[model samples]
Every structure is written in C-alpha cells, then in structure tokens.
Target: MGPGRIAGVVTVPELAEGDRLTVDGVDLRVRVSARRRRFALTIEPDATVTLHVPDGRPAPDAEEFVRAHRTWLVTKRAIRERTRPVNPAKRLVEGEVFRYLGRTYRLTVADDVPSAGRVRLVAGRLVMSRRAAADPARGREALVDWYSRVGYAWSVGRLQPWAARMSAAEPALEVRDLGGRWGTYEPGTGDRGVGLMCLGWPLFQLPMRLVDYVIAHELAHVRIPGHRGDFWRLLRRALPEYVACRAELDELGRRLWMGEIWWGG
Candidate 1:
C-alpha cells in the first residue's frame, strides 16, 4: 500500500514443498514443484484434497489460498466423489458391461471363468473367472493385466512411425495404471539415452483411432516435453483432429473408468 495504493498487488498462484494439513476438519495435501508456474487446488474422486504450489511461492500463501477456496473444494469433492467408481470391482457384477478396444462386452462372472488366460470372449461376452465370483479385486487385476499386455502390442505399432520419422530413438513402452494421467513421456539422457513412456492401461478400452491420438501425443513429447509452441505444431501435423479425439476420449474415459457401464453384450 505504498506507491499505488488503489492498484497495489499483482500475484500469481504457484507451490514450493508438499505437506498435509487439516483445515476446518478437512484434510489437505500440499505438493510443490518447480516446473509448476501457478497454484492449483483440486479434490480427487476419492475426496482427497491436493494443493499444487509452484517452487517460488510461499508456504503461507498456499495455506491462505486453501482456506479461501475451502467452500469450492468441498463442493467439488462432493460432486466428484459422488460419481467416483468404487474401489476395485465394487461396481462389477454378473452380466455387467465393459468396453475394450472400442467393442462392448458383457461380464459373465462364474467360479470357473478361467484365469489361465485372458478374460474369455465367448459369444460377445467377457467371461470373468472370479474364482467363486467373490474376489472382484483379483478379477479387476487380471483384466487390467490382460489389457496392458494387449496395449503394449498395439502401442508399439502405433508409435513406431513417429519414432522413425523424428529420427529419435523409439521410447520403451510401459503399460500400467498411471493414476489420472493418460500417458507420460520420460525424456532420454536419464535412462541411458532410451526414452520411457508410461501409458495408462485403461486407455485400451477406447477405439484404436483415439488410442493413436494419445500415442501421437506422447511421441510428440519425445522432442518437445512441454505442451507449448512446437508441441502443438508437431501434434497438428500428426493428428489434425486431435482436439475431437481428446473430447471423445474424455467422455469415453469417464464411463470406462467406472469399469462396468457399457450396454452392448
């Protein structure tokens, strides 16, 4: 309040270190990253609160920001948690439907569903060997493993061209549960000049065309790490309709994450 009293301060949100706090009985987790340029607060579907702070920001600033946005956080958590898919196979049941590679398949839970191989596709149905139809968690694990194996194969084919054209080394593909990220590209010169990419296994549930878009996106990151400037240019040249594919994937992803909502058997 010295030089310009009326228009005194200009601030941008950002984070420094990560820690947890409790405010008004709501638990908050704060994470700081130097790469982040602004402060962000979010509530995961599990109702966990997270505050992202940039490196240069003060800790007190983050605490105050969280306090100011408490109401919005609570509201958002309520909405997201209400729609979150239950833990493991909480939503899976007999005759439940799921999508894989863009095709709808019905879940058939049986004691002898057969876990020796991938989930059986018989007569357009996904036969789940729940081992007495009781351990839905194991069932989900088996299914995810199967999807990862398949995604590895499909992604290799989809990503090869980009690797070759860019004259860059092909990134090693890793299929796993990447939390909420669609895909991640870890640059080379860190792991012996070999790039590593971790793609969320759930993406295998979408159409190959959409999956191609994600592959292209990550491949684009091989040369450009951040989503700025040349990144868009490279992506546009690879996939002109990336925006539409992203929208479709987001919609399908929301339903797919539920793990049991498709209707076509």
Candidate 2:
C-alpha cells in the first residue's frame, strides 16, 4: 500500500463530474470520486473524497467541484498525518506506550518465576518477567508463544458456545491456525468432525466485537458454505453491527501484520 501525504491545495475549475482527485499522504491515501451535481467526503480507516451528479452530467467537472471543498482537504490531510503508523519495534521496550481496550499502557518488564511469561492486564498494560533469552530464536519463540496462547484462550472461551448455538451440524469444536483468512469453518469430513482455524495472534489487536463478527461469519459458512444472501442474513442476525466491526478489523490488519519480526540472528 502507498503512503498517504498531504496534497497542498488542488483547485481545478474545468472538472465536471465522475472524476477522482486523490491526495496521498505519508500515512493515508485520500481520494475524491466526483460527479456533476453533488459531493461527499469519506473519511475513516481509508479516506475517500466523493461527488455525485445527474446521469447525463459530464464526468470531468470534479476539478471545479473540489475547489469548494478545500477546507475539508486541508483538515483531512492533517488527520492523516496524525494517524500515521507507529513503529512497533519501538513499542517492545520499557516505558513505550501501546493501546489495548481503548486505553494506553506503559511497558513494565520484571522477573516472576511462577507466572513468568509476558502478560497484559485488562487495562492493556504489559507485564514481562525475567526469563531466559539465550538467542534471538528464543526471543521470537517467547513472543509468539505469549501472543498465541492469549489469543487462543480468549478466542476459544468466547467462540465455543456461540459455535454450538449457531451450528447443529457438529458435536465438538476445534481451533487451529488459519492463514490468509481470519477464520474458516469446515463441516464434518471424517473422524475429524467440525473445526475452526483462526489466524495467529490477530485477536490481540482486534476488538472483541470484530473477533465475534469473524467467528459468526465463518460459522455461518458451516451451514451456507458460500457467499449468498442466506449467509449474509445469518451473519447479520449474529452480528447486527458486523459492518463497523469489519471496518475496525481491516484497519487493525493493515497495522499489525505490516511489519517484520526478528527473533534472532
């Protein structure tokens, strides 16, 4: 994905309609899709500038139209710069800040023999205890292990009963690692029965609502097995606010999985 940058000031009087003007900032991609008669600004995880016009209107009139929305352009550019991604590597050290449950938590590292792995509180604060870090691979293992266990436990506790309530085609439920997709549902195949594969560590950053949306979406597939109206209806029934949850997840996905992880040399 390209970085978003502030486009100083764009004014074109000849633009009519059905035209798009995008100002890419260092952190966001802002675009305006315009038409002859009207326009609206789209801003959230992805910034979009849009306009509408009558069917017969010329498609090139957007340049002139955008001249009217210049105030919005400047405001949005400032917002994009503020929302730019933070370096995750810097977040690994003590005194750094990270967000969890809509709150900021400072990192605190210490040594605890019994409950000795890295853990986070409901407030999203990190608690790291003293442990062996013989090599880089060990550090990576420690990190992945902590993230996976927390993500898995949190997911299973929430999903088990929801899965039961949603699907009657199975007796037992299972969880595994999923790649490329957030989660998947498979009907009984053999002695294997029914199962779910949730991708690694995503639950850490994704809100509970989004995780539930994914679980319901994939579980709905157990019955529908495809993207059809019925599947959507089921998903909607399970998560009425699925749309917002989906948007939030998409935003988190872009941030979390975008960086590199170095375990060791």
Candidate 3:
C-alpha cells in the first residue's frame, strides 16, 4: 500500500491523449495537437469542455491557462445553458416529417415493396422499407445515409462556384457526420496535394442559403486557416451579407436533429 496506489495497484500520472482534469469545478478534456501553437478552449455541442494544448506543453501550464480563463468559461457556460436547444427525438413512424434543403417530406414505410432498397425520395416522399422502419437504428442510419448522398450531390455544384468567387482552389469535398462541427477544412498534406472539406450530414437539413454559408466558410479556410480578421475580410469579399448569414446559422443550427431516435415503448 502506497500514497498513490490502491490495493497494491500503482497509479502512474502522465499527460496523454484523452486525459481529463477538473479545475475550478469545471471538467476539461485534454487534447494535445502538434498543429496548435498555443492553448485554446472549445465548448462542444454537448457542453463538454475541451482544452487544446500544444505539443510538449506541461500539465501545470494547461491548468494555469484554464485558471486564467475561468471567468470567460463561466460566462460562456451560463450563456449556453440559457440558449441550449430542446430538439425533440424523432420516431420511426409513418408520415413523420423530415426536411432537406428547406423542403419538407413525409416518411413512407413501404411494406408492399418487394425489396428493402436504400432509402429514396420518390414522388416527393422519403420512402423507407418496412424492415428498416421496424428497427429504430436501421431507420436512422438509412435516413442519415440518404442525407449524406443527397448533400454530396448538391454540394458538388455549389463548391466550384464558391471556390471561383473566393479565388480558392476547389478542394476535395465529403458529406458525413462531423461531430460538433457543421463543416471542417483540412489543409493538404504532402501525401495529398489538395485540401479536403467535410460537411456534416445534419447541415443538409438547413436551408440552401445556410448550406452555402457553410460552404463559403470552409472555402475561406482554404485561404486563411483561422477565423482571424483576414479570414472575415476574405469571406466578406465573397459574401457581402455573410454577417447576417452567420448570425442566422447560430440561431437556426441549434434546432437541427442530431440523430436522436425515439424508442417507442
């Protein structure tokens, strides 16, 4: 038995990925990044606090950073608590409404159909096989898959135009689940010559304008990595009304469904 041991089990303290620390009653998930030049903090959509530390930074320095920013963190958390969205869980039932690119379509469980094909939009209805509808997980997967496919198709056409307008290269694009991010732009590495942009499937549920805003926002990152003054200037050059679009996105994005399924008892 030792001071830092329990029942003959020795506990080793080290800084590594997925490390967690509690400072001033706030839980922080520690993440070390080589690309980061300084310490930064981000509040996730689920209200989880993440502290981004630069490679080689010590744990004590990270704790000091959190302590210095404690006031800001508290204010932000309070604001988030008041503004957090109450998005309802969706059920896999008939006539349940779903939105895509600002258009509403009701769900149709096709039992009479011979095969349970991939979810599709036929005759203005989102058709899902009865087999999938019977299972909540399958139904949710089918719907998200549909969104990813359709969103990718729609974004392909929109990408080039925005790229041209912003004087940025048209990088590789993907549509999928980007947890806590509507869009992300990764600069090209030595192995990959061109950058990559990934948009969350849930973003497709927003209006076309908002989708365009996200596209343009990521494209701006192609030129400017961070959201500094120069980045906003470049974005404004392409979209004069970008300020309004950003504000609207913040307000509307809170209400989007994040794949929560309602299991009817």
**Per-prediction backbone clash count:** 5, 25, 0
lDDT of 1 by residue, 2-74 (tens): 1223466754433335566566787778877666676788766466878877777755676687788888887
Q: Write the per-residue lDDT of candidate 2 for residues 1-265, one digit (tens) a residue.
A: 1223458754333333444444332222223233213443434433443444334333244344455666777697567556644424433445645443234566565555356554545345566544523233443445556656766677667666666777534323333334334665545656776654554453455566776777677777767755668888877777788888877775675565322343433
Candidate 1's C-alpha runs over 4 A off are 1-17, 20-94, 109-118, 122-124, 130-132, 165-168, 189-191, 258-265
Rank list by lDDT: 3, 1, 2
RMSD, one per candidate, in order: 8.1, 12.4, 4.1
Write one digit per residue (lDDT tens) for candidate 3, span 159-253. Answer: 99999999998999999999768999988889777999999999999999999999999999999876789999999999999999988887788
TM-score of 3: 0.89
Residue 76 displacement (Å), model 2 = 24
Ranked candidates (TM-score, high to low): 3, 1, 2
Point to the candidate with the largest lDDT: 3
Worst 10-residue lDDT window for candidate 1 reads: 256-265
The runs of at least 3 residues in candidate 3 whose Cα sits more than 4 Å from the true structure, single-residue gaps closed, are: 1-15, 112-117
